[model samples]
Target: MAESVKAPKTVKVASTAGSAAGSGAAKAASKKKVKGGVINVAVMTLAAGLIATMAIPAYAFNPQGADAAQFKASAIDGMKKAQSQSVEVPETVAASAVARDAASATTEEQLAAAKAAEAARQRAAVSLASYASSYSGPSVSDFLANPPYPNFSLDQVFSVAQQYIGTPYVFGGSTPAGFDCSGYIMFVYAQFGISLPHSVSGQAALGKRISIEDAVPGDVVIMPGHDGFYAGNGNIMDAPDTGRSISIRPIWTSNYYIVRLGI
Candidate 1:
């Protein structure tokens, strides 16, 4: 009975609700700590990645290494090979170049020939001038006194006149060296003892006016300010202007009539 009475003494025990509430509070605290730790780890990882990127050199991402150098060398070599390659010229293009060269050469040759011909003409003119300037032939007085073709016919007079065909023209000259228009007539007729004036009008008046058709080769051709020997067939033989030799040529004008000297 005494043991039973000692066990009946009251014992202090905790409530279920308080225990559950305390357990919930501790669980919330643990969750909060775990979330904070996860956030800290993520922050540290981002900081380490930023530091690593900053530590790297900018050239690390560039492709300018040995491969780029080899590509540049290959490009340069290709350019050199292209420059050294020989391109064949087309036959048509080559022939065109040759033809152009030949044409240029021919033009040069033609120019040279023309220059030579002009020089020759000038030389001939100079020779004639020199021969006229240095002449020492018979004078008009000597020729008149001697009268080489005395009693000569008109044909003989013309034949004698032809001997001085190549004589040069000179102003107011009547010798064999050079002769003017009227002076030539005077000198020629002097050989046949025919006294004539050394003037166009005077000589024209001393002869008979004749038609051109009826004129002979020895007849005188009288123009407005000129006169010559009628060479028949509308031609005349006379000393022309300055720088020209005595020659036979066609009558240049229709304003002229024939004159028979011994009419």
Candidate 2:
């Protein structure tokens, strides 16, 4: 009598269907959580991309290009201010920079000019020193300064030569106030428009070469005793040798000659 128990087939089928529905609900919930995790990752990625976009501009404008970055920032600020106030900014800023550059250039040019002037002064001093060294020794106007006679005329020069009778003898004198042997002759004849050599032997070689026999009143007379203008009285006035004054002396050497100073 105890073995007659039987289960309902519809009730068993309903329990299996109910278990399957519960499993499906659990799978759906897991899929939704996974999808939500993916969405959060994508949001983080978007946020990171946005941060990179902003940081790249900041890195490019770092210390290496600080001046240019500051200028750009100022320009943007200026433009913004200008837009707010309806004014101009580019021309005023550009003009200020140009003025500063011009002032710096002018100062540099002034310094260069001063240096050039100093260089020119040094060159002028050197040239003047060179000129003083080339002309040395007594001049040739000694004998012509004082003629021995009152009747001597410079031949062909059409002029009477007489000056400096008692001038003191000096070592290198060329003035009427004092006379050197060659310098006295040089000083006297220069007043009469005569260009004579500064040396004794050199003066005797001027004009047409002539012998003592052809000597005249205005003839240049040379002798070993001394050179002078020959007076008809046979005496000559000459700035004599060192420690001696100009005097008239007889021509005694074989080196005596007469030189015509002009044609």
Candidate 3:
């Protein structure tokens, strides 16, 4: 019985030893497989990096060649030449500019004309202001001889008339103080021993009727209710109105007739 038990125990121990040896051999084989897989992964990664490097475009990896630089310079020069080309102005735009210049010139001319007109007005006002209550002009005979009138014999009448140029206007008074239209004429002519009326109608009826074309200085110019001594051309030396004075200005009426005192 003792021998039988001992033999069974020895057999069981041998079986366990054989199982432990087989497990150790399996573990060693698994470690070798894992090492081989790591080496394979490393090789695959290196190959992928090499492929990525080769995938980059060749131009990006290299400098520009001489042909590319020459082409770029040629394109830049062509652009510069095109930029330097002269641009044409539109016809409408050019015409508009010309019109503006003409308008400016017209404005300047108008300004000049207005200034000249103002100057003329000032001169006329100055001339009007120069007269006073007591003024004597040039010698009447000398002034009248310039045009050689046919009435040269009436030199005393003209001289007396001119001396009263600045006399004030009055209703009917006929003195050196003041005189009316007909009063002025009657007074001036009376100084030379000539008889005249103080009425324009009476004076007009007494003189010899003559055409204005044949009238001379010292002739009588008769209108509707007015009369004056003819100075020359269309001017008269007369006391024009009540508030105004005697003046040697242009005649006021176109419906006037000429007459001579026959002196």
Candidate 4:
């Protein structure tokens, strides 16, 4: 019985030892398998890196080439050739441009001159209208037919002249409506058939000179460039000048003489 127990115990110990050995072998085999898998993964990663490197284009590393450099040089040469070239205009075209500018300037000058002439014409028309408007009274023919004075005496002539005392002074008037210095005398004498020129100097020559002391109210008073009716005591009655009416005023100057018409 002791031998049998001892034998069984020995068998159990051998079985336990076999089981531990089998477990250790399995662990070693698993470690070897894991190490082999790691190595395979490393080798695969190296192969993939090599494939990626080989896939890239060779030109990506070195961009500039002979063809690109030649193209850039050709473009620069074309630009320089275009800039250096000179464009010439035709002589006829240049002449035509000059003539066009000259014609434009001449046309402007003519238009300005025409406008100035038109303005001058308008001003003359207005002045003529004003001159026409001043005369609305009797004409020289009316006074000639029906003489206001029965006798052609100096006092009678002056009395006939007094009827138109308020007439306006016109530059070249002779009617009752308006009168200048000499026109007043002419109009007054025209009624008496005493034809006198409508000029101060002409009228002065027609009359006989008289001393101022012997002068009467109807005598003609002659000055250097003017004439009027002598209104005794150094007074005169006549149409004076522009913007003035026929009026009576003291003789303004001493360089004057008295004259009697139809003397």
Candidate 4 yields a Cα-based lDDT of 0.81
Model 3 agreement with the true structure over 60-79: per-residue lDDT tens digits? 43456544644455444755
TM per candidate comes to 0.49, 0.37, 0.42, 0.49
Of the candidates numbered 1 and 3, which has the greater lDDT value?
A: 1
Model 4, 1-263: lDDT tens digits are: 45543467868889999999999999999999999999999999999999998865443354665446444545447457668967799999999999999877757779899998787666545544676776675566776777665477877887888888998777677876567899889988888877789899999999999899999988999999899999888999988976678989999998999889965
- Rate residue 11 of model 3 by lDDT: 77
lDDT of model number 3:
0.73
Provide the overall lDDT of each model, using Cα atoms, as 2-decimal numbers: 0.82, 0.61, 0.73, 0.81
Clashes of each: 0, 11, 0, 0
- Can you tell me which runs of candidate 1 are displaced by over 4 Å? 1-133
Q: How much is the lDDT of residue 29 in candidate 3? A: 93
Question: Tens digit of lDDT per residue, candidate 2, span 82-101?
Answer: 67855567987989999988
Q: Give candidates' CA RMSD values in order.
A: 19.4, 21.7, 18.8, 21.7
lDDT for model 2 comes to 0.61
The TM-score, computed over Cα atoms with residue i paired to residue i, of candidate 3 is 0.42
Flag clash pairs in model 4.
Answer: none
lDDT of 1 at 103: 75
Measured with C-alpha atoms, the lDDT of residue 225 in candidate 2 is 35
Pairs with backbone N, CA or C atoms under 3 Å apart (clashes), candidate 1: none
What root-mean-square deviation over C-alphas does model 4 reach?
21.7
